[model samples]
Target: MSSYLYRLGRSSAAHPWRVISAWILLVATAAALASSFGAPMRDDWDVPGARAQQGIDLLREHGVGGFASARVVVHDREGDPLPSAEIGTLTERLRGLEHVADVGPARLSGDRDTAVLTVQYAEPITHPDLMGNIEPLGGAISGTVDSGLQVELGGEVPDTAGEAFGGTGELVGVGIALLILVIALGSAVGAGLPIAAAVAGLAAGSSGIALLAATMTVSTSAPMVASMVGLGVGIDYALLLVTRHVEHLRLGHDAVESAGRAVATSGRSVVFAAVTVLVSLMGLRLAGLSTYDSFGLATAIAVVFVAAAALTLVPALCRLGGRKLLPRAVRRNRPLRTREPLTARWAARVGRKPLVWALVSLGALLVLAAPVLDLRTWPGDASSQPAGNTTRQAYDLVAAELGPGANGPLTVVVPTSATGAADEAVATLRADDRIAGLEPVVTTPDGALSIITAEPAFRPTDERTPDLIDDLRAALPASAEVTGWTPFFSDISDMLQERLWLVIAFVVGVSVLLLALMFRSVLVPLKAAAMNLLSITAAYGVLVAVFQWGWAAELIGVDQPMPISSWMPILQFAILFGLSMDYEVFLLSRIREDYLRTGDPRGSVVRGLSATGRVITSAAAIMVVVFLGFATEGDVVVKQLGLGMAVAIVLDATLVRMVLVPATMSLLGHWNWWLPGWLDRLLPTVRVEVEDEPAPERELVGV
Candidate 1:
């Protein structure tokens, strides 16, 4: 592997412009074909399961060409049981509108604060853009509604449209990320590199996923997740290598020599980091669930792409640009600034109280992580019009005025039994204490099953809803089955919990083993695994505080609290575990390099931390912008993903990398580098990191 890398560097060095121009062309081609080559990453885009498929199938069959239609519940602030005269008037007006084939037999429930209206579209349900009918409905209803009524359209149509709306957010987020890079790196070239790296790296990641998506149903969250993870790490890797190259060139080394040194150092670190992150992410597959499996594959592929680009494309770019990369004054005074410093002042603090700093930093992370223990996994209510819109106001006013379950129903598909067993199963569910209003599903004589709609008093993940499913599952006779929105949600939750440990174990265990083999010390991998886990927990805690607890939704632009994304835990594990290691590997590899050369454990950490810390932070600050940018997104899936990762990166860089690591090393002393005598004797000490200045630059023959 080392030989292969060496050869690559040599080849890239010889035909530097070719390598550079190749990457440029590749990136251009990728951007041009991005949408076509890498399809949008959406959940419902191709949801599986017999239930979801059946719904789509039924919608298509019914000639709803657009999709199976859903009812929009426009709320009336005046109350659910608005005067009968008004209900009749409003219903007639909406029913008469174009594309609205049928106005639901809407009813004001006994509570008198909410109503359900069924809408049927005239176009074929599969008409690609099914929501074409819905937009007009919202516009017509919003304007035509009596002031007292607040409108909400439930069912799949609005949810799908809401998700589509997030595509706009993706573009907005990209621009914001670019702006942030300029602020952090202080050069448009520097700022642009990360975004460019991300664009290229993630394009490759998505292309890889297209292969996976073709074969298996990836978790809906995979693309959203891999995009951020790949972008952050890709940029971090590029920033480290590029900045180091720039620093080298400033010292009088030609672009080729500087590029070589930067790669020899930062390239090594980026590879280590990428490998570590890959191990961490693959651990999620240990959970043995599809959602996590999707996460593991999506992120692992991205790590490899980013790491490759960092070493190959970045160096090539530096060499291609030549003297143009350096500032004019630096070109004149290059030799003075380029000389390597033996060690910074802070690196000399190796003998300080490592334990004190370690504990202090660790404790701070624990505090930030504390709130996650209280985390509520509420599925955020899906709404249209900023949360305050009449639709939202009506939703809140009605939900508050009536009760929580006043929202629309969860759709469940059951076997159509002429013997009435299917109906009995539903009746059994309606009789359960957990459910509110249950509706029968009408099926064609052809035997296509339909969904029974029901409103559950508790949240989707609420125990009552799952318990009700259990009761119905028990009540079913031979040849009968029941599954819909709530049951499927329950199954997914149960699957996640059951598989979470496997993922954690696999991710941690595999990463540690790999780290151990690479570094030849058990402590190296163990500390990394522990520190990464700590970072993740702290991030989740932050997620709970903000998105879950609704602490500062306005600051982040979230209009309301939402239930956690169904796939968030796995997404969190896949992205956070992978990324935490990106920084961990960056910092650790530098320390390892120092330790190997100086044979001083304490001295190694100090110099290593000091050297890598600033770069890590610079990389993180750029990532924070990308992440926080998406926090403004309307999609709950994107928001949770963005905030969760952003929070994790911040905590990892500040607490885990900067403070906690130093303190722990201070306390452990030589123990940090300990290896058993017999094992040490058997093992050939491989220099994974070197403390010495890069050996006097070595030149290679012509290509």
Candidate 2:
């Protein structure tokens, strides 16, 4: 396997022009297509939901213009006319304003105390600025005249999360990215390459993703995701490859040879690591979840581009760097040596204190994982939302004064063996205090299907409100199987339950399966899995404590502790798991290769650590750079994801790779290589070789 890679390395060098040109063409074309077809990324990036469609339908049915069609809801002290005599006088005064088709004679809602105002408008709500009209909707009622009451505004616009939910992501994303990069890289130059690569890759890759999305029916988030991961890994892989090449030049190899050397060793490692990430991400297909499927597929595409860039552009640049970058002392040239003492030192330690190291690392990881025990999940509702989205604001207004259930419609469906059966179910649900407004449509007349439009006064992500979903399900008639935004959410609840195991199995099983093949050992995979699990658990705990439980919240600038979003764990697991595989593959491949060549378990572990550990650190550093970029995106979720990933990468690189892997291997001794002989025979061997001369300008150093 090494020889094959060695040959590939030689060939790429021998035909650098061809390999290089192909890459240029690919990227250039990709850039063009991407830009020409690119679309601005939008969040909630999901398709228009049934509720949105229903609302649109209702507007059309009523032929409601933006003015007269608008509905203003006011809730105060449970028994307030809302705009009292003083308030109503103010409301009446504004009734004569232009664009006011009609201000209905205000009346209380079904609850009998809160009032609903019908504001007739001349236009449909467009830009947020137009929402200024909401201030006047308060008409005669709000301000000092209605000082005793808490008057919250809810009209056509606020019902959509209002104008305030705008640009939250943009502001947050930028701030977080800047802070992360400055801290992680330390030096300006160190930060530049990764950021440059990430920016360029994202710019080009997003365009490609857009074109693909147009043709492929992709989810809205695909483009942003593709851009994010593409920039991250592209810069990361390039970082390691270039850094290795530079080090070789520093050692006194010719530029071409140094480039070849870097390409063969570090570049090959990247291919393997990236492929591992791709494979792990591909597990999404088995998750039986479309969201995961989209995420996995888009991520895989980005990985492919990253791999290509590392192998091609990075090497081309390395070759170009040559004598210009190599120090005079390094370029002077000397006899080459392959022996590495650093490996020997690690080997000695493993043989000496493996048990202590392993326990300490494992224990530390467990402490981090502790936060998972109290993990809280939140839905994608207004308050818990990243903030500034119209839906988020509108939902917040409804929930703040109304009650917890305000954002979604509740649908009641009965197993109607006959017609009108649905009507009875609808009526039964209507009588329930939990539901308020009723709008039935599109179902067969057998009353088998009826719809109730009820909003949760609390945010969707709130624990208390989701409980209502459970209550509605449990309390509703046995004949009814509810399905609406609330239930479609609840509706998929069971399905997701069934698939969570599949997701876990796919991630764990594939990881183990790959390790078994790479090391030809059952024990290696088991140990690797254990180590990875510990690391992942620890990272999750940290996130939960910092973000969810808000431990040391002030340090992170979180104003308050909020429950973890419901989808956060899933997204976090997918990303972290895939990234964990990145470091895992890099380290294991090196160790296994060394073991196969030297057949010295202890020495192999040490040697592997020595040869690859530095590079692993470099790779992790680049990944941190990538993650830090996202933190700057200014959105809370982006910040969490970025920081979470950055922390996890730093952990895997230093603590897990540098310390624990070696220590554990020392304790395991030959058990690290233990495998059924027959099964071992089935494992495929992979090899990488460096051929051709080291770049004329570079030389091996400290060998």
Candidate 3:
């Protein structure tokens, strides 16, 4: 592997302009393709084989393409239901809008302070232009506002549009990463090279995803997430190569040899880390969710581009800069280290007190992870919207006037042999305490399917809603099934829970095998997996504390505590596991290198820590900063992802990497590198560290 990378880097350095030109051409072509054929991404949350999915299929078979309905809520501050005259005017205008199939009669709240008009679309609210189609509805309503009258739109359509922060988080993340790189490398040119590579890689990635959207059901959030992951990892990958190349240059190696050696060593780590990430993300397919699959695949593509560019583009750029990578003054007055690096010093201290540090770090992580026991996974609803946003205001108004459950009503379809079950269902439903009200039953033309709408007594976000669903299923005929927004989301959550264990097992199994192959150690992979999971669990606890427990929810732009997104845990684990493996590969691979050289476990730990600690921490810091920037986004789900990832990276980098890793390695002694002869023979030899080969002897006759 090292020889291959050395040859590849040598070629790239030998023809630096060709590598740079090829990257430019690829980026330009991708951008052009994206601009020409790219379409907006859609979120697909439907769970295959779920009960709700069956109901939806039935509805689609019935030629009922327009199952998505919304509410245009008008609040009259004059203490009267939206004037019947005004309701007629708004309803007439809404009926005339494109994609709008029907506008139901206005229903006034019992308090006569608000009126809601139900608007049905001609198809499921999945179109990219849904917001464009609905903008006129809001605009029309706003014009009617007078004398304390307010208008807002809510329901499936508006929710599908979500909120756009216009990539602000990505920009802030890049800026902070640039500062960190500058500080670490101590040269603007040195730092800028990685940032530039990251930008180019992200641009190419976005273009590729945009093109993929033509055939695949990519989520709207995929680009945002891909950019977030790409920027951080891209910078880190390039930073590693550039840092190593500079070290080689300082050791008196020429530009080409330095680039070759750097890529041979550090570049291998980047590829291993990237492969781990891709493997982890691919585990999302085990959950059987299109949205998760889309995000996972999209992010995997971005990481591929960044990782490839780090090996090819970054080395080319490093060769181009040559001695310019360092400031002139520093290069001329380079000083040798007289004292051990701080990382080595700290490692020595922890090595002597391995048990104490290990216990303290493990105990802290476990404590932080305890809150995950109470974690709830549900699709966040209108309640998670910004406080003053129209959707949130409308939700608050309905919950205040009509009841929380009125915000989302369940639609039940039952195949009846006669009117007997239907009549019994109405009576039984009314008598049930959880059923707030029953809409008139509408039977199919063939009388084969009877549709009954039941309004629950609690909101979709309510814990009791799941109970209500269970109770209704129990009371209804065996042929009857309940489905709607609430039930649909609940079904997704249930599906995720069922597959969670399988996905975890698959991810862990595959990850362990990969680590074992890379490190050639059974115990090393096991320890890495355990540490990765510990950090991830700690992150989940943070999500529960902040989003579920409403701890400083407002500070992050959430109006109230909400259930974690159904896809969050699955997505989080996949991404975080992969990211955690990155640090694992960086740290452990370095330690393995040192161990092989010194054959002293204690000394190797200190030496390895000193060599790679600053780089790893800087890399982790870049990732954490990028993730935290996303946490400030207006979309609650994305916000949760950002917060959760940020917390996980922090825990993994500081507690797990800085403390637990060194302590554990110290405690394990030489056993850390042990692989049984039988297993070692069975596994393929994958080497990430290569000893520096002596420069070929040159003939002195010419001189």
Candidate 4:
């Protein structure tokens, strides 16, 4: 594998333009194909076999409330009753709009200051043209807004548009990454190479995601998530290869040979790291939701393209830049570092008291992870959106004028043949004090099915809302099934909670197996898994504090405390666990390389830290910056993912990698490299770093 990569790198370096042109053509072709053939991306939260889905199926079968609906809220700015003439005109306009089946009569608030016009669509929200109605719907409401009334659209139809993926976050993240690289690499050309490679790869990956949407259901947020992962990993992967190549050039190796050697070593680790990420993402399939599948597939595609670019384009660019890739001081053949690096000194100091360092770091991680014990999760609703969002404004108006429960009305579907059951269920619903209101039973014209709407006294995010769902299900007859957007989200949260453990086990187990094969060590993989879990749990705790506990919520634009998104833990575990392993692989592979040559465990630890510490921290800083930039996104789910990942990366790079890993490995001594002879014979040999190659002399610039 190493030999193949070495030859490939040398060939790419020998013909830089050829390699460069091939990448350009690939990216352009993907973009063109995506533009011509891509399907529109949308969110589909269906849980196929869940009760909520079953009820929806029943409703759709009967041609009733299964379709999408939205609320056009009109509020008088001066707290007076709205003009009836304008309200009636807006209602007629909305009914005439495309896809709008009916506009129900306007319901006034107690104060008569706010009115809600319920617009029901003929098709479901996922229909391609359903979103098309948004523009016309806006046009229909313009005259009302032109009057002295505040108008906003909310509910399933308007919420489907979600938050747009503005390029501000990506541009800011990339700009910051380039700045960090310039300072670390100390050469304009050197700094730009990785950014260029990352951007090219990200373009290809994003185009591929669009193309994927043509063939399968892709989430609206998939592109943004892919961009986030692709940019961070792509730059980090290229940076690793560039740092190694610069070290070789400083050691007097020619550019072509240096590039080959860098690919043969650091490139090997890149491949392994990327594979670990892909493998971890595969666990999302166990989540049994299409949204989860799209997240995993989208991210995996990005990683694959980014890794390929790192293996190919970075080396070619390195060769093209030649000595210009080096800092002016280094190109002048000045002396490199004359003293031990601070990382090496720190490693030694920790090695002197491994037990103490390990215990302290472990304790800190545990404290950070403590909040996860109180973590609660729910699928996000419009209420969780940014306050300025129209949906949020409508939600607030509805909750203030009507009850919070009015925002999440539950649908109960019963067969007309079970008239006795329907009557009893309606009675039960009306009797429950938790039920704020119950609508008259509406039966099909042919009397095949009956539909009942029940409003709760609490919002969807409120704990009692789900409890009411449970209580209603228990109280209603077996023939009556409860379902709606609110119930569907509740079911999704329930399903994710049930499968999260399985996802964790699958990701961790597979990663450990892969690491054991690569390093031929049992304890090493175990220790890495444990450390990764600590960092990930710490991230979860931080999420709970900020998002759920409302600690500094305004800092991230969260308006109030809400349960963490149910999908966050499983998704974060898969992505963060793999990303955490990236630093682990870079550090350990170098340590293993040194240990093979010198057989001095403690000294190898110090030497490995000295060799890879700066590059790892720099890579992590770029990742942290990139992720935190996305934390500013309008979507709360994206914000949670971004902030959680950034925090995890910081903790992993510093507390876990710099402290806990070294301390544990130092204390374990020879056991850190030990593999049972029987197990070693059974496992296939995999090398993350080339063993026979000579280590390059250390250089002062970044390496």
lDDT digits (tens) for residues 1-703 of candidate 3: 8889999888888889999999999999999999899767886655666777777766666654326677898887677655677778888888887777789878788877788888887766665556424676776676567535788788888776667675787678778988998888878889899988888888899899998888899988788778878888898899988988877776677788889988999989999999998998899988887877888888988999999899999889998898888645556665534677789999999999999999999999999999999988887888888886778888888888888888988888766675577777787788998889988988766657778888888888887777777788898777777877788888888888888888889899999999998888999999999999999999999899988898987788776778888878888898899999998998888888888878999998888889899898888888888888888888788899999999999999899988999999999999998999999999998887667467644311211
Give the alpha carbon lDDT tens digit for every residue of 1-703 in model 2. 4445445555665566786677566768887876787543322312133222343333334444212234444556656555466447545665665566567666454454555455655554533333434555445445523566544444444443333323344345434444444444333333343444445445545556666654554554555556556665776676666666666666666556666677777676677667667766776666455556666777777777767666655555545444544434334554446555564576577558888877787778888888889876544333543344433443454554455554455545444454565666566666766565565444434433333455544445555655666676676666555544454444344344455567667777887887676556788778777776677667778878987777875554454566554444555566667677777776776677677767788877877777666656666765676566665553456556666777787778767887788887877877888888788677775443233443344325533
**Residue 218 in model 1: lDDT:** 68
Whose lDDT is greatest here? 4
lDDT of 2 at 391: 39
Best by TM-score: 4
lDDT for 606 (candidate 4): 91
Query: lDDT of each model, Cα atoms only?
Result: 0.65, 0.59, 0.84, 0.89
Worst 10 residues of 3 by lDDT: 694-703
Give the per-residue lDDT of model 4 (tens digit) for 594-692.
Answer: 998899999999999989998998899999999999998898988999999999999999999889988998999988999989998899988775677
Q: How do these models rank on lDDT, best leading?
A: 4, 3, 1, 2
Q: Where's the lowest-lDDT run of ten residues in candidate 1?
A: 694-703
Give the clashing residue pairs of candidate 3, or none: none
Candidate 3 backbone overlaps, count: 0
lDDT of 2 at 609: 76
What does candidate 1's lDDT look like per residue over 632-688, in tens digits? 676666777788888888888777776777767766767877888887777666445
- Lowest lDDT sum, 10 consecutive residues, model 2, at 42-51
* lDDT, candidate 3, at 275: 93
> Every model's Cα RMSD, please?
5.8, 7.1, 3.1, 1.9
